[model samples]
Target: MSQGQHWREQLHEAAAQGDTASLLKVIRSAVAERADVGDYTLMSRLLKRIGRDEASRAGLRPVRVYIARSVTVESWLPYLAVEAAAAGFWLETKVGGYGSFAQELMSPEGALRDFNPDLVVFVTDVEDVAGGLPDACATGKPELVRAEVERGVKTMEDMLTAFRHHHRARLLVQGLCVPDPPVLGDAGDANWEASESRATQRINEQIAALCRRLGDAAFFDENRLASRFGKARWRDERMFRYCRLSIAAEFFAPYARALTHSIKVLFLPPHKVLCTDLDNTLWGGIVGEDKPSGILTGTDFPGNCYRTYQRYLKQLAARGILLAVVSKNNEKDVREAFRVRAQDLALTLDDFISLKISWQDKAVSLRELAQELSLGLDSFVLIDDDSVECEAVRQQVPGVLVIQAPREEPWRLTECVMASGAFDTLSVTAEDRARSDEYRAQAQRAQLENRAASREEFLASLQIVCRFISALEAPLSRTVQLINKTNQFNLTTRRYGTSEVESFAADPGGLALALRARDRFGDAGVIGIALCRTQDGTCTIDTLLLSCRVIGRGIESALLWYIARWAASLGANRLAGEYIPTAKNQPCADFYPRHGFRPAREAGGKQSRICYVLDLATQMPEKPAWIQTEEDLNNEPGPSCARVNEEFAR
Candidate 1:
């Protein structure tokens, strides 16, 4: 058999055996030979097929892939193209010549027209930018350079916009990986080296701006990759004077894999809730005996760290992550700490979803918290300064992520929690920042509910006001905060960046609403957010989550009514939502159904996949008298007693 046929047969055999390494070797050989024959189109198709097969086998189910194409070094294109395709993404390949200005080069609109990939990768060497710049700079005027920069920025923005508008695809711009200075000494004018560095930096900046504008863009710093691997591995003197194809392949391959995975994750809802431990975990001293006033918290060294940690926890609460305190402290002391000393403390009792302050084992308290919140122990992140407690939770809850509280320093505690990257979301919204306060307010409402004889009396005596902000103009900060922090009450739990939220608002069918609640005690600020998208005469609740503090106050029901009524006014026929149960959001497990939604299907128990459809033709429920109808809450200043206490009330 001929060399090409022999390699193809070997590749087929290797693929049959599920031997990735051997299959890749065959693919590489085919790519090398095809490049020699200059049949790039064939190479592209073959690579795409391999990628699709691999991704399917891996169960990745990738929707799109971005391929950066260069004409000058045509040999490398097929290899990179196949690599991306093998990873399971539909390829979005940019076609342009080597040493061509990235700004001046236009991708064949046809190549992207049909594929409509979800990601666009920019692959090119330093020479590509350098090659296109000199002609524009020959006149050497400041105005010309400025104009060129503007054009470059505009070009990148246009390219990114095309993908975003056409396919809602994310863009991944790779930095050029140039060989170390030594390899370039033997090639071309030495002065080109400095120019290449400057040009590459400019191009990278422009690409970063595009990503900023596009919101979902990612820039892979390949310069760091080249630096990690010595330059000699990629530098070539003959084929392309200043190319680093080998290094690009090595780094880009793994990067492509990561990017593809990220896209998949970005669309899926987040795991809800984060449970924590107290008593030396959230604060410095044990609260059981230490006078609440003596507890370590506030704006001082180690105390400051604990305070900072509490602030971080408060931020989490605002984002909708249910905060619960499971401690073996006396209830009286703990309650006092929150009431008297907690003003100076890092977190207050109101911020927690549930507080179990009995002298019970931590495991028992954790179970109680989970039960009260209607969550499973598996979703809890048991953090304690005591390694013994961490180990205990690990043994009791196998899936729970146990983190050791920073024993040596208090400030490092927040870093430890953030580093888990478990709660790393795209952005924080305004509603998120108000979450702790809302939850606190909810707790007070619950207290009122317990005091009154009837539900009507409790709600009326409590003087509750559920203000619906029809036009959420100024509280953009709170809106973004909720998008970032609220987890448990979040229906879709789709975390969005600030720019992405802005873009959503710009779109015709996207709507964002913020809700604020208040009663006799305090203003809850912007506590709830409902993000929806309109499609085919239906309004889909992309996210519907509220602070756990506000869980029992009927806020969720009110918010649902608001959405349904708004959809009716918009002439939408159906209102839809999903109830994706998570470790912490069990409190809302029956939320949709309780609000008159029916289950469309069930994906076994692995996913309680429910699709609710509400006919907008029905008469909308009357707004509750107890629920405030004021559209703006920011007009009312926060209560005076708000900053009176800082520490827990022990």
Candidate 2:
């Protein structure tokens, strides 16, 4: 066999034997020879054989890539990359050491320009800042390290700018992983970790700031992951494990893959709604029999935990996850708990999209809730403290994700859920932070409409403003979010990735617009999004979705009006859209007809598509004064208005 084949066989054998030293030798040898042995693809295939394809597809596989030349990089990069890749990601494997920050930053841009990639993964070692190693061993001295780190930061910023300017590639910045201070003899001495942790923290902070400024990049916390595994394990084992030959080459493979998988999942959007149980789940006891004061929420050790869990849920609600109650309890008791005793409760009934408190099977209740919220069962997560309840829902509802509550240690419930990492995302937008308040306002609007006697009167009283703007060079995070989470008001129900949205906007034929609404009750944040493309002077709506909280207020009509007007301004003669229904989007089945668009075609099943068109040149109805003009819309900073205050009061 040729030398390349010989090394490949050696690697395969080392991987099979789980020999760490042999594996490292093979990897190092491959790197030394610059042998394009396709190790990443080989490892990914092997992982897929074990039914662990999630990580492989994410591109976290073993391959050498140029990392900064420092004692920390020399010590940690190989293992970190292997673990991260095995966790999933096809890593670039070009091993060359950089002596300075400017070199490190500029090198990648040249490499990227030569070899175009969809994503770039950058890792920095915390040791550069933490400072225990001698000056000769580290990349730069204490005083000089700041400039080096800044250069690295600027390099990333420049690279992202280039990516946006050229290929529009996505960037994932991995935080520096630190050695356990205790294990490294730096623990408890405040100063030991102070300089190091602070340095690493500063680098991460810079990285995050860059991500926000760039608008498309994401920051991943490698230190957080390393911390979770403990400093002792990272120092004593991880640092040296990948360097030893006798250890199984593939022993850390799973861990690497898991890390990559976790990062990829973090980038994926999260579920929009949470379906939770009441008794012993949200609180410590049954509300039906126990007096509001009798419930064990918000007091001692265990109660504190339950309260902490509720607070976390409230935080989640604030991030725009529609909270709904699915419980088997007395309706009056539940009502009193939130109304009278819930001043201390982390969440209230007003926060939920739907509340079903009856003896009905939870699976059935969930179905009803989905219908009410205009969401799919797949988009909902079911949380209950009872194992039987969790299992029953899982068995009955195939798509419903069931999360069991902490039965024995009720206080640990919050930690358990958080640990599951169900809600982690690459970034959170301003719209997300105000989600709970928006839902609360939505509930009040519903109540008012029910009593108003006429839809027109209720809408008129709303004094709602619907603003539309042509897509700019702004971030697509909010647009991507609405596409993923919205159901009831989603006309086409098509979800797009960040990259896809960017591509759509760049296309001359395509169109993207954001819709914001506010009323006397409160500002609803950015509640609606629509993306379309023009063909033969006809504008076709590729995506149309709005948050449920802002529905029933004539905002939909206002939005359509804006689209029609925009199409006319663009000199398009016709406006086209589709109605593809999901289980939760039945509410919008008749939406097009109501908006003066007629179906030109139809198909079958959930996959069925419908096409509609309207002549933009034809005079449309007078734009509602309540709808804010596009220019006026840009003046408002965020969703802050009396509408939110009124909703909170209600």
lDDT of model 1, residue 395? 71
Candidate 2 matches the true fold with a TM-score of 0.68
Whole-model alpha-carbon lDDT for candidate 2 = 0.61
Q: Please give the CA lDDT of all the candidate structures.
A: 0.59, 0.61
lDDT tens per residue, model 2, 346-395: 77776677788999999999888766554567667878998888879977
User: Top model by TM-score, which number?
Assistant: 2
Error of 1 at 429 (Å): 2.9
Pick out the ten consecutive residues of candidate 1 with the lowest summed lDDT: 640-649
For candidate 2, the per-residue lDDT at 596 reads 74
lDDT of 2 at 87: 27
| TM-scores for all predictions | 0.55, 0.68
